[model samples]
Target: MANRFLSDLDPTTAWAKAAVDGKLFTCGELVRHAAECHLRDIRHGERRDRATPQRTSDNMQWIVNAVRSRTNCAGKILIEGASFSSSRNWVSNGQAAAFDRLYGPAGNIAFSPHSYYDADASGTDASCVAGAQNRLDPPLSWAAVGDREIFIGEQAGSGLDAVCQFVLPAAYAKLRDHPNCIGWTRWGGARRRGSTYAYRLDPSNYQTGEDTPQMKLLLRFLAQNP
Candidate 1:
């Protein structure tokens, strides 16, 4: 879930109401339901509004409390400290403190950030900018300050020759060198035959199971890093 807005999770909101009607959650029961279901990790919010830091922090605290209160659930929670587009201002703007108050001492919580190498870092474009790997520097500095662990929840470039040969290797190297960054998951793995996503990892045919260029690159990186 992108979970882009506070209203996205607000039960009173029309969309959220529709979600509830579909049995997504009862009011005040989103976290509880996840806990009861024993999810391994719950990313409560992602790239929330930078203007509403307090409400975002409060929402996260609510999730932390819900998880902590449940002895039967051992799942961890993941947080994104800044906007999906950039983490550049997060630490300096006191956003880290708001989250630290709730998440700092909790061992079961970690920072999860989505990263992309495209010009806008939106993962919508197949073309990548030169030296896009440097985008991780800001988030890396933020994680270092709190001695926090990081999991790159989403990352990918297209299967284009230039992207696979240059963009991905540098990005993978950056993540590998950063000890705080635990690992990363590649985006766009749809198995549908007609899917048009740029970064898909699935093979063209299920039976043949031929690896895409992106998957082959990923496999090579995994072997080298592992």
Candidate 2:
């Protein structure tokens, strides 16, 4: 409607006249145009991420910093903040630093450096081993975060022992024994690989009323670490 209306007038002068010529415009047209622009601005604001990046990052930083300090967790607590989530538009450096100070003081907060293992990249296990020793431990690039309680949070396998066996024992120990490492986290919840939803490890699903082999492993680690 706006394009059609503007097309009938002198292209050059019509726009300029719209700014000053009350004679060429009606009150209804002016109100409707204002409403259009107002709606446009409103929609533009809505298109932004669920929250502003800085705001989300700020919240993330707070959550990261509080990992060690959360009183709700009564035992030795370790957190695995994934290396700067690109999809989430958060940088790794900032996230890494949030725990840097914490590690020095309390040694409870730590981040999981991405090896791209679960990301289906080539030779991820090798990458995980290297990161565990190099960056995930003390004297990493951010030297402030030295020898702290580091956790490798992954429930190995692609939801099956067969899948996890390929990476277990072989690559698992290197990650567990890496310098400064304290424990592990199994991402054994719900995961998708190819067309199948990887096995769900809700514990209750087991007929023996016991943990699956994977749960047994994680539980053993917790028992030993705590």
Candidate 3:
């Protein structure tokens, strides 16, 4: 992350510690400034530590603005917000708020909520999303921000066919045809596993250097929907 994006968080560069020790900003600074202190590099899976889950989600807002100004490809970008631990139900609230903040500031960006496996039987589906929304349903910022901007990114297990037939369709129906939904993006474009991850939709299995049931399914859905 540091070699490329300069976002890596080192212990010495703690943004949160700086804020507390430097004594520069007040509680009002809590929401906007202070990079190392906010733990922008700290992800959702780390929420188990009890430091504070939603903190990075709120802090990422500034990072969003920075990305737009510096990166040329930020235009019409699909930004996946900080996500909760896909393996557990522990951090859904933090994920929800992060999703909102990531896409709230500019029309150039769209929300891509990462959907990895959870025990709930509804991972990436409407029901799962609803569960995540418990802390902030429909995101209080959605209406004023924009509609047709929500996209669901999925990480289906090796059962790509099942996800295509069941998860994708169910999720699409649940989203209620938002018109702007980007549908799904398979993690690692389907190659994350030596085949270990729960959603082992490893591209090597179905992608014969070209074809993938997942992509085909998503394309078909988009064709039909569009």
Selected candidate, larger TM-score, 2 vs 3 = 3
lDDT of 2 by residue, 96-141 (tens): 4544433322434454433223433222232222222222322233
Per residue, candidate 3 scores C-alpha lDDT tens digits across 44-115 of: 234554224355454456556655554554466554443332313223446554454445345666555554
Model 1 residue pairs with clashes: none
Tell me the whole-model lDDT of each prediction, alpha carbons only. 0.65, 0.40, 0.44
lDDT of 2 at 157: 40
TM-score result, candidate 2: 0.40
Window of ten residues with lowest summed lDDT in model 3: 126-135
Per-residue CA lDDT of candidate 1, range 1-226, in tens? Answer: 5543444443334344454455555545663433332211223432234234455566567667766774456666787544542443345556666666766334677777677778777787877777777767777777788788878788888747675468788888888888888877788747642445678788755689987777788888789878
Residue-level lDDT for 125 in candidate 2: 32
The candidate scoring highest on TM-score is: 1
Which portions of model 3 miss their true places by more than 4 Å?
1-53, 70-74, 77-79, 83-106, 117-148, 157-165, 173-176, 188-192, 195-226
Q: Which segments of candidate 2 are over 4 A away from where they belong?
A: 1-77, 82-107, 112-116, 120-145, 159-164, 190-196, 202-226
TM-score on alpha carbons, each prediction: 0.73, 0.40, 0.47
- Give the local distance difference test score of model 2: 0.40
**Candidate closest to the true structure, highest lDDT:** 1
Predicted candidate 2: what Cα RMSD to the true structure? 16.8
